[model samples]
Target: MKFVSWNVNGIRAAVKKGFMDYFNEVDADFFCIQESKCQAGQIELDLPGYEQYWNYAERKGYSGTAIFTKHTPLSVKYGVGENDSEEEGRIITLEYEKFYMVTVYTPNTKRDLSRLEGRLQWEDELKAYLKELDEVKPVIYCGDLNVAHTEIDLKNPKTNVGNAGFTDEERGRMTRLLKAGFTDTFRHLYPDTTDRYTWWSYMSKVRERNIGWRIDYFITSDCIVPAIEKAEIHDQVLGSDHCPILLEMKEF
Candidate 1:
């Protein structure tokens, strides 16, 4: 089975830039996208074999997520707990027979770190939610998490330290989550891999220089690690500031 995740940045804009072409080419079993920035009735997709599930933010054209899967889920959930987080439409959980698949577009801390407290609070709540789900079955969690977990995750860690996504608070939450029994599939498979990133700044020549951050991820319950066949960063694919990351696994 192949699972793919990407932050389209903006679905409407990406479509014009060949999103459908790449979507058709990959043909993933579970294709999850973040930052969709649109609501139902705003756009239509003619994906013949896939079941589309979308979680749109209350605020128009803001943060949102969607999942297109060939396999229908047994149950679907929009957010973690209360409806407080549902406004941004940041998370979607699909319960399959064997495992739970969750796609999350984590809240960003903003350049000025204004949202750091809220971001951290969300992480705590999210971690608890994942643990609760894990008690029932293993999980396949993927999306643009919006944090660089370690120095190896970004090009200029020293300079980027304490910044929005690289702040100690943000990175520590990721470490704590992993310690709680989840494995970051990509780093687990290729520990030494560098210059391989999922999201890049849209600033001039940044993407071309390969200066980016590996904020997107495919994290799974530690018990599912043995099933992972491949974890890859498709940095070459283009349309948004972020590219797709893939996880191939043996069928459960």
Candidate 2:
């Protein structure tokens, strides 16, 4: 099975920049996207063999997520809880016979760190939610997690240490989540690979210089590690500030 995840930053904008062209070429078994920034009826994607599932935030043209899967899941769920007040449309879970697939657009702490507290709370809630799902079955969690997990995850970590995505609190949450049973598929395959990144800054010449952060990920239950055939960062593809990451499994 092949899975691909990309932030896209904004789906509509990405489409204009050749999103469909790459989408067709990749032919992923499951294609997950974050920050779609659009509601239902805003856009139409003519993908033939895929079941489309979208979760839109209450606020228009803001945070959202969608999944296009070639295989129809046994069940599909939106959000983390029944009474959960989260309205950003950040999460979607599709349950198959073999495993549960979850795509999340994790909340980001603003550049000024004003949202740091809320972001930390979100991390805790999401971690608990993932653990609950893992108890039932192995989980394939993928999306823009919004954090650079370690020094190697971002260029110039020293300069970015206290930044929104590289803050100690944020990175600690990611570490705890991985320790709880998930494996970052990319790092699992290439532990020492450097200068590989998924999201780049839009500032002048940043992307050209490869000054980026590995914020997007495909994390799976540790048991599924053996089934992972390949995990890659497609830094060459372009459409949004973020590029797509791929994971191929020998079998579910």
- RMSD to the true structure for each prediction, in A, is 1.0, 1.1
Instruction: Give the count of colliding residue pairs in each prediction.
Output: 0, 0
TM-score for each model: 0.98, 0.98
lDDT tens per residue, model 1, 1-252: 999999999899999999999899999999999999998899998999999999999999999999999998999999886543488999999999889999999999999999999999999999999999999999999999999998989999999989999999999999999999999999999998888999889999999999999999999999989999999999999999999999999976
Model 2 ranges off by over 4 Å: 83-85
| Residue 104, model 1, lDDT | 98
Tens-place lDDT digits, model 2, residues 1-252 = 999999999899999999999999999999999999999999999999999999999999999999999998998888785534358999999999989999999988999999999999989988898899899999999999999998889999999889999999999999999999999999999998889999998999999999999999999999889999999999999999999999999875
> Lowest-lDDT window of 10 residues in candidate 1?
78-87
- Highest lDDT among the candidates is held by which one? 1
